[model samples]
Target: MTMQTRVNPEVRPGTPHQMGAHFDGEGTNFAVFSAHGTRVDLCLFTPDGETETARVPLPERSGDTWHGYVPGLAPGTLYGFRVDGPYTPDRGHRFNPNKLLLDPYTREMAGGFIRHRALYGYKVGNAGADMSYDGQDSAPYVPKSVISDPETFPLDATRLRRDWSETLIYEAHVKGATMRHPDVPKEARGTYDGMASDAMLDHLTRLGVTAVELLPVHALKSEDALLSRSLVNYWGYNTVGFFAPEPRYFGPEGVAGFRRMVDRFHAAGIEVLLDVVYNHSAEGDHLGPTLSFRGLDNASYYRLAAGEPRYYVNDTGTGNTLNVSHPQVLRLVMDSLRFWVQAMGVDGFRFDLATTVAREAHGFDRSGGFLDALRQDPVLAGVKLIAEPWDIGPGGYQLGQFPPEFAEWNDKYRDTVRRFWRRDRHAAQDLGSALLGTAELFDKRGRRAWSSVNYAASHDGYTLADCAAYTERHNHANGEGNRDGHHANYSENFGVEGRTDDPAILAARQQRVRNLLATVFVSQGVPMILCGDEGGNTQDGNNNAYCQDNPTTWIDWDRMDEGLIAFTAACSALRRAHPVLRQTTFLHGAERTADGLRDVEWLDFDHRPADWSDPALGRICLHLRGSGESATGNASTDEVFLAFNNTPEAAILTLPKQGKGLWQHEIDTARDAQASVSVEGTQVEVAPHSLCVFVCAGETP
Candidate 1:
């Protein structure tokens, strides 16, 4: 039964207690925070969201919030806001009453925002630019915010609260993951329904990823430049509305589709983490279009320059930065996060350019208000909070500086693992530090090893296939003169640059793939993988395919490297089965007991004690066995030894002795698919640029 009341004209002044459009069964309350607005008009839309039906002025103002109640409006009602305030741009105010702004707290937005010149606050070709006024109606070309009672979904967020130590994040785009899959119905392809299908759920469950960190699904504005180039924002980093889910990813039932998607993921014992961009909105720089935040309260919502109020602080390098310093702006962010978790059923969030979120007046304060609020928030403190941890601003490469509540995306681990697998000199030290969870960075402040979220590949960089098959970033299709992505990719092609016909090069590239996969899974800390990297996804060496939404970015399910996929699966299974690999506490050099074997022992290729400072050594031999408390409070696990060979030729590695039990080899990157591990006498020959794993029972190496 519909829980909405019939439409009527019994309008009343409402309290400014809550933000956004909230329907309370009898009436709908509309509230928005605009600190500098003189007047706020609530523009109601037709059923099709095309024509403006009525314009009601909000009659109450408490603090910076403008609020009112439309006594008979129901949950399905569509609306937008137009706030009247100062129009001058020199002093950091860009308000235009003609342009309808989206409610920052809008739960569901109707997408089909037709790009038109009238949507801009300033006239298109006027020399006076932003100074000139435009009186055109923007309702004809913009999306309308919908009134939604987010209490429509089931509230069972108890089961999905996975600890950081057990999280295996699978970073993927909603459309790119299952758009071409044969099992997903043709009509449901690339929609939220498709991602929630049995095939997608089965794949994630079988692959053993505990969580799926989806690329941005928030409603965003397609950049005009990319539109002119006939490309869309595949990454969805250009966010316009935080609370609203992207319409393109939805099916016939609108918000219900996303709700079902999250429900299904949780049902499969997998968590869902959204890649959110709250640092800035879709509004571009000085010459950018005036969207929601820019048109509503630019001076309050954005961080204007202290010296020059008209200019913005370009900390995010995304043209503008959200001023989280403002109380109302901070409230918007906190409310948005809580809404996504409690109302929308998402388990966690991965903040993109997260350093910008914690920035204060002095610049990048660890104890900033944003982090302080998040730490104290009961709803958010328990969920997974991950940060990209860096931006393009000055002093923005903050790797291990986040609060204890958050786990940072470890790029150092990615680079060091790549260099170690590629046999760079002096890489053993870096690899060893990463394999131990970067104790120097995270061991302080009562943080655990899981604070460093390790990964070999991510969505922003080259896939594992590209990392082994291409040295240079071939991003020619990004329409930016092949200069859009990173230049130093830490990638290498064995004998060919892109693709080759040589069997030896192909074999070598496959070995490198297995090596990288084994590195992430075998190393400590939470491991993340790019979605199709397990299936050999490639963008023709395109490291940055942010704008290419076609096959260049989509995962080609048919062309998967079956052998590499099997290897990755085995690695994931090994990581899950062996508690010794996923350690919660730091590995001390001491043994588990006084006279027992060590928890972790470092050795050279000759089975001797390792000289960590030696620059000539490039191999990593680590024997790991846990006896202390882990993340789950249980420890005693199997003893496992891992050997990584980074040299140019085979090396004879001396083996540790056991009473009567033999060391059973588990993995060798040099071996073929499903290769049996035959016992080699007393010494094992490790091939060049490969990794090997052997399970031992009461052994010392």
Candidate 2:
């Protein structure tokens, strides 16, 4: 490799205070952290990033970082790093000057990885394995990072920051949400613009979702194993660049397209929440290819095993866990989060495998450094914080275990709701606890019921529409011979496994879906709905479709279940309108006042108190009073009563005389979107296998 045609771009010593490629109007200042690297070269590529035109070494070494300033570099300048150091495997240094490495803080990139043998640092198919070094030039296959000036982007000033108690989250993939949307323009489909189009916004706004919790948007690359199968990592969990938005999701305007999408969502009064995966990065462990973090500073960026430097701490189920215990590594995660909130105009983040972020040298700690840092951070603490609350590490199932500042995805809520709807014996007790926001689990430490982020379906599991349609997972299309997905679904099919022409079976399945939706919306917590589940989105029982990026993951707008969609919207509206449904305080069976009814009371046969110990119990009623704001915050006082029956025989529900207002039927899962008149009397017959929601002082439209 000769540099005979290289041109001087007026390079100078650069500051290492900022940790990314920041381009001012005059030039770009490049800075990267590499505690153990001996030398770092900044390789500049041509406009198209196909050829390297020049190689400039960073002239400054501040502390452990290497930096340089180019006098005439532009914001879109394409470049990558080649840090020269010892290629030691046992000591956890995989740096190779031959391979081009991306900056961990890059905001945009020009290309993606092309499958080539030279991308890997170690020689392939050699007996020496990772212990052997290969000096093949990987500039042609690896992408170059684009220099983007964060100060140049203008964020919308009207971004919405909804209260966590009132927050209703819609978990969606940007591509799958609009790819099959017929009303969205053909060219705009699957792009950021399509998600912000009138068709998408109108639907989301009408549904009354306070925020759209988008799946991973961090720039990622497909796994080598997947690439071998001609498949891609559709979920984007394998993050290659933390700051850059995924290049595939961008429109012709590039990074600007993502900003526009956020602006439009904010304009519609809907918050944007990003499902971030910071526990790990795209660069896998010892045998994986040397990418951004691995190539730049493997030992500093990753959590190598205490005794074995060549191995990694696989706490994230990925190849390696990010070493957030390291201050610099922690800074990268925090900086990326702030960039999304301040620069990208996102409102919050739902951290994937959040337990790892708080994992220290020993175990998960509530007062861990990362958690404490967020608690003290002025920028990060004010925004909404949601955690997946668990990882593949030991003692990782931490539902309802996060600090008071965070709302956690309550798998207990998910499982109990599914079991109750499926009429599992002895599920009534767990159902009652879940309906009251699992207070037994999360009520202490000043945390409210809203700390539970409740949902029945998510992107990683079977869709809501498929929950009652198939008993077993059908993930053959995922190319894993159907062995990749979960084995125990806790799901049930009425009679047939996949599809049936029997009207009775179909109606039963539909009612079950409605039942689950009712439970989620009315429960005392922050409700989250899987994006397309409201429209009866089905993945054909593919519980784990993280790799299938085709129509299987995309929302089928043409054949959408309109009835279920309308029902879901109605449920969302009711939840938004009624304060009793979303309680900041845990629900107990005590009256709000001396004369008023209970904040939440369970009723059995003939208005008798529920016998929770009854093993065969299949029916119950939740009488919720107009308890407002937990005697703390300011909110509305609205009353509601929900009756659910899983029995085959109809039960006559006696509505209590609350002495507040008249009772009216707002929802009946047995009927199709009907508004019944306000009942003058107290008695109402609840059909078998159905859910009923009644409101006070209500009239039929």
TM-score of each: 0.95, 0.96
- Candidate 1 lDDT over 1-701, as tens digits, reads 01123343555788788898888888899889888889999888777886676776898988888999988789878888998999888888888888888888887787576778877888878896777778887877888898886466434445388877777999999899988888888777788888878988888787898999999999998888899888888889999888888988876556688878888888898998999998998887766777799888999999888868777888888788999888988998998888788767888899999999988888898899999998899888688889999988778889999988788899999999998888777888899999989888888788888888899889888999999999889888888898789877889998789988899998888888888888899888899999999888888899888888899888888898777778877888888988788877778676665336688899877888888877867676998877564456554557788888888888887767655657778889887674536455558999888888987644434
Tens-digit lDDT string for candidate 2 (293-388): 888899999999998898999999889999898999988988888888878888888999999988998899999888888888877756889999
Clashing pairs in 2: none
Range of the 10 consecutive residues with the lowest summed lDDT in candidate 1 = 1-10
Question: What lDDT would each prediction earn against the true structure?
Answer: 0.84, 0.86
What's the TM for model 2?
A: 0.96
What is the overall TM-score of model 1 with all chains considered together? Answer: 0.95
Runs of candidate 1 with Cα error greater than 4 angstroms are 1-10, 149-159, 629-637, 675-681, 698-701
- Superposition error at 244 for model 2 (Å): 0.4
Once superposed on the true structure, which residue ranges of model 2 sit more than 4 Å away at CA? 1-4, 150-158, 593-596, 628-637, 658-660, 698-701
Question: Which is the leading candidate under lDDT?
Answer: 2
